[model samples]
Target chain A: MTTEPPPDAHAAFSAVALTAIDDVYRFARSLTRDEVDAEDVVQETYLRAFRSWHTFETGTDVRRWLFTIARNVFLRSREKGKREVTLDDDGAEIVDAALAREAWSRGGLDTILERADLGPAISTALAELPEPYRAVVVLVDLEDQSYESTAEVLEVPIGTVRSRLFRGRKLLQEKLMQHAIDSGLIPQPTAPVRSTE
Target chain B: MNHGHGSDDRTGAAAMDCAGAMDRLFDFLDGELGPETEVRIRQHLEKCGHCFDEAGFERRFLAAVQAARAAEVCPATLRARVRDALRHAGWTEAAGS
Candidate 1:
């Protein structure tokens, strides 16, 4: 016969996952640039994750799945429509095309990335990579996920993922190289004459 | 795989689109390329200045991105905020009450 276990004084919750919590916040931050929005997203995501922890399968990549859910919540909030349309991104079918027009007309990305230090320039360049490209870059380049896994999370085909990643990287490289030129990281073209020698 | 510097014919040789090049580049950088394609790209680069620059630039750029990722640790205050939120959400026992 087994003795009835007395009520444990320990907290019912698992340990306060400091790192995991920070990751949720950061993932939220990456998804939404606004700090307040990010905080709200993080809070909601954690509440959901906590409530469903028992259902989360063992040996699965918890962080990746968590990111998918958080991204969904963020998108749902965006799809709910803003009270007043901000001058930034609104992904509705027609609105987004208009937004694209405005973004393109501003030549928002035409300025060559000035190579100051890798930190600031790279950050700015990364930010400049346009909507979905930016997300793919953050997930694959920054977050270090495999292509298939990233596609699964982003809900795009593997080909789409590859295309975006390649496009983003090519653009980013050009920006950084331009920065390098301006910042004197690389020597300027020696005399404008094309060297055929 | 042709390393003929003066050759203008890329038709019969292995040429890939931007998408394919990109996929191969990432996999190659990650050391996932087969020996054949790897050698082909290497020989291609030796003759094709543009592709050579593209490959070189991406290789260096990925390293920089890796370094950037290394430094992206979240703020300590961010963590504390999460903890506080968890407490408020009644996610912890003592804190839940």
Candidate 2:
């Protein structure tokens, strides 16, 4: 026998949680990196959120709440170890920015960014990124969540979010550069470059 | 890391140079820094064309990534599936009733 949800609960769930289906689905897809697995995660997320609708405080950020639940569901489904990555990222930001500048100047990445239809390529690059960095980038850059909010969702400290976010951007930049070169969007380097520095 | 930008100690935006400004470019672009720091970086950018250009490239890159992902939405099938699951779990909202 099922205890039916009350009228208001149904209305509230529909209004708040259901409205964020797209955003939550995108976040789930970023985490799982597979459409089928992502759909499963989103389904479970909505069901769990609906079941616990009473616990959700009204007038808060619905998207953040749903994202928290979705992330947890994906993690549990994978049942992998903790995804925390230790960082010695003291100068990584400067180094990454400089290298990206080098790539941009060398490859005319400005043109690639402006004129190219990059949705598929960006998705592929993002899918290939490691989990920790991908999560931060998706939450902060794609989902437009702030660092503080992202930290809360990922259950990491604020510093971790910043470091991973920078590192993720760096990796994606490098990958996109290579993608451009491979796709003939940019010319191959005249000299076989050895070091990124 | 070090772009040879002396100590991290600086008085204000007046003392901030290209290296210091460039180092904090991501934080500035992300709007993650405090007001004073943000103002300092902005002030430096306003005066320094080189750092400003570098910041522009990075900013555009981030915007491109955001634009790429913005088009994706929850698929219709997943939406229907969730609606059905909700109904099964006592949601009581009939479809097209």
Candidate 1 local lDDT, A1-197, one digit each (tens)? 12221223114223433335545665666668667888777766766666555555656767786777777778777884343223222323323333334323222222322222576567656655555666777777777776777789878886677766765665565455445556655555443311110
- Predicted model with the maximum lDDT: 2
Put down candidate 2 lDDT per residue, A1-197, tens digits, no spaces.
Answer: 23455677888788778989998988998888889999999999988898888878999888889999998898788674365333336336534654655643534666788655777777777776666788889988888888888989989887788778877887777667667667777786564423332
Best by TM-score: 2
When only the first chain is scored, the TM-scores of the models are 0.63, 0.81
Q: Give each model's clash number.
A: 1, 0
Candidate 2 docking band? acceptable
CAPRI quality band, candidate 1:
incorrect
DockQ scores for all the models shown? 0.22, 0.40
